[model samples]
Every structure is written in C-alpha cells, then in structure tokens.
Target: MIPDADPSADQAPALAEQAPLTERGARTRARILAAAREVFEERGYPETRVAHITRHARVAYGSFYTYFPSKEAVFLEVADLLFQTMIQLDLVPSDGYEPATLIRRANRAYYASYRRNAKMMAIIEQVATFNVAFQEMRRKHRAGAVARSAKAIERWQRAGLVDTALDAEMAARALAAMVDHSLYLWFVQGDDVPDTERLLDTLDTLTLRALGLRP
Candidate 1:
C-alpha cells in the first residue's frame, strides 16, 4: 500500500552521482589537490595563494575552501600523497621472495618513482622552510616510508632470512633513512656521478651485504 516514489526524484540522485567534478563534491576536492601540487611546486607554499590553486584547477574560490581550509592543508595532502605512493611502490615485492630480493625490489621501485617525479623532488627542497606544520607533516610522511621498510625487515626475520642478532625494526629504519637521504643527496649534489639506476643497483647489493645476506 505504499505510494510510488516520484520518478524525477529518483533520477536526481543518479545524475548527481554521474556529474563532472565541477558539478560534484569529491571530484572537485581531487581537482583542488591536483592543482595545489603544481602551484606549491612552482611557487612554494609561502608564495603560493588560494587563488593560484583555484585558477590552476579552473574551479571557483568557494570550491577551494570547501575542500581545504588553507594552503597548509593542501600542502599536507601533497606530502601525504607522496608518502603513500612510495609505500605502494615498495610493497609490490611478492611475499615469496627472499628478504634480500625484496629489499632490492623495493629499492628499484623507490628510485623509479623518484625519476618519474624529479620536479616534485625539487619542490620538496623548498618546502622545509615554510613552518612547523609542514615540517611535522613531512616527518609523518617519512615515518610512513620507514614503517614500510620496517615491515619488510620484520617479514625477513619471520622467514628466517636474516640473523636474529640485529633488531629488524631498527635495521629497517636505518636502511630506509639511509636510502631516502642518499637518493636526495645524489640528486642535489653537484658532483658528476653514476646514473640513478646504476646507483640504486649498487646500493641494493651493498645493502644486502651489509644486512648479512649472501649472494
């Protein structure tokens, strides 16, 4: 005995779900973030403004604020995205591989990512000066990367691939930190050196040896 619902009302929800980002909410938020990365990279966070992001996004100013409260929020998202991407890439190594093989696979994945986004890598150099908020966000982002490495090491320990003498978590943190800092320095340093692929390969072998893994 229930009345038939209005057809037009039923159609509205479907249309809303299919609308373009300019007309939808979450899609608009993604657009803002996409624009924010380019703007932040080009001008740095302090010099960049909301107008820049909105203009780059081709969205309204109101839309920008609807998604992010300030430029800081957008910058944090950028850092978070970078960290997430790194973890996603590193974890692609399969569970069946030995710890050394997994470590090498993860290293290759990380360097491939860096090569793909060299510009964003450059932008990171400038972001540290912005404020404590940015600094804290960057730290959290790095900790996530370190955690990924730690997980792989723990897996190795569980599999009996590495010595039980060294603390896996500590070793992982040190190794991850070393790789991150070394890659950054290699990119920014002024001396002529081996290409990224070669450098990463060398590091992979060296890291395995240092971790007491055999050939």
Candidate 2:
C-alpha cells in the first residue's frame, strides 16, 4: 500500500488502507498518483478534483476509488513524495569535514534543489497555510533537520570547533530558520534573488558566521 502523508498528524482523518496490490494493480495505482500530481500542479489543490485526476490518468472513475478514497488521500501521497526528495538532500555524514566546506555544500545543494522544485514547493507552502496536516508534516520535517544539525553542532563542540556554551538545539533552530525562510522568500514569495553562486556564497558565509566560524 502507498503511504499517504508519511508523517501524519494525530488529528488528521486517516485514509482506509488497501490490501496488497498485484504488479498490474500497483502500476495502475502509480498511474493514478502520477495523474493526481499533474492535476495538482496544473490546478493547485483547491481546484483539483478526483475527476480531473482520473481523466488525466485516462482511467475509469471507479479506478480512482479502487486505490485512493479521495483527492486529499492522493494529494497526501504526492506531498510525501516531495518531502522525501528533500529529506534525502540534507541528511548526510558530517564527521571529519570542515565546517565551511560542509556549510557551502549544504547551501548549494539546498538552493539548487529549491530552484528545481520551486513550483511544487510553492504549492506545498500554499497548502500548509490552510491544511493542518500539511502544517504538522512540514513542522515535523523541519524539526528532524534541526535535531540532526544540533547533534552535528554538539560534535563540533566536543572537538573545540564551535561554542560549547551555546544551546546546540536553539542555535541549530536559529540557523535553520534563517536559511529556510530566506529561501522561501526568494523561491516562493517572488522576492528578488541574487545570482546562484552569489546566493549560495552568502548563505554559506552567514551560516558559518552563525556557528561562530570564519567563512
């Protein structure tokens, strides 16, 4: 069965789980999901309907219900797929690396990925504004990254690289917020963004400075 919203909110209504699908059934389900993503991208969430998804998939209307109970169920899976792409980018080994190099690499990776997925990212941001489940999922995803960064900072402190007196979690969250919202403004809010290399360089410098390191 496909995962609908990998990290679901407690208050969110659950979709009914389907039984294991055969190969052909799986292919059909995948087609429906792909169609749903296209519909969502073309029309945004509020304007998309189950009929639109099935019509785009070129499947009978009943085929949509056979796999997904509703448009929201399918959209949740689409959102989770987008979230997974982001998770793969930031979770990496940090040991035995220079802070400046790692910071630059991270900013470059994040900025490039955001640029590629800006359209879908914009849609997700819009969804999060009104959808509690989407909001919770976004929050949990950021929290996981912040927690990972805090662990890395703690390791840096042990090596006498970063300030030992600072609260690692708090410091990590501050840096995360700085990067996250700045990217949001440029990528989603139509703010003026510098050239790619210049933007990444500034992000790298600012992140290093925040961590009390020379850029």
After superposition, which runs of candidate 1 have C-alpha atoms over 4 Å from their true positions? 1-23, 90-93, 188-191
Per-model lDDT: 0.65, 0.73
Off by over 4 Å in 2: 1-18, 90-93
Candidate 2 backbone collisions, by pair: none
| Top-lDDT candidate index | 2
What is the per-residue lDDT of model 2 for residues 1-215, given as tens digits with 9 covering 90 to 100? 00111122232222335699999999999999888888888899999988888999999999998888778778877886666566455423555557676777677677777777787888898898898867776676676667667877787778898889989889888887787788889888988875767776777777777778755
Clashing pairs in 1: none
Top candidate when judged by TM-score against the true structure: 2
Model 2, residue 41: C-alpha shift (Å): 1.3
Query: Could you tell me which 10 consecutive residues in candidate 1 have the lowest summed lDDT?
Result: 1-10
The backbone clash count of each candidate, in order, is 0, 0
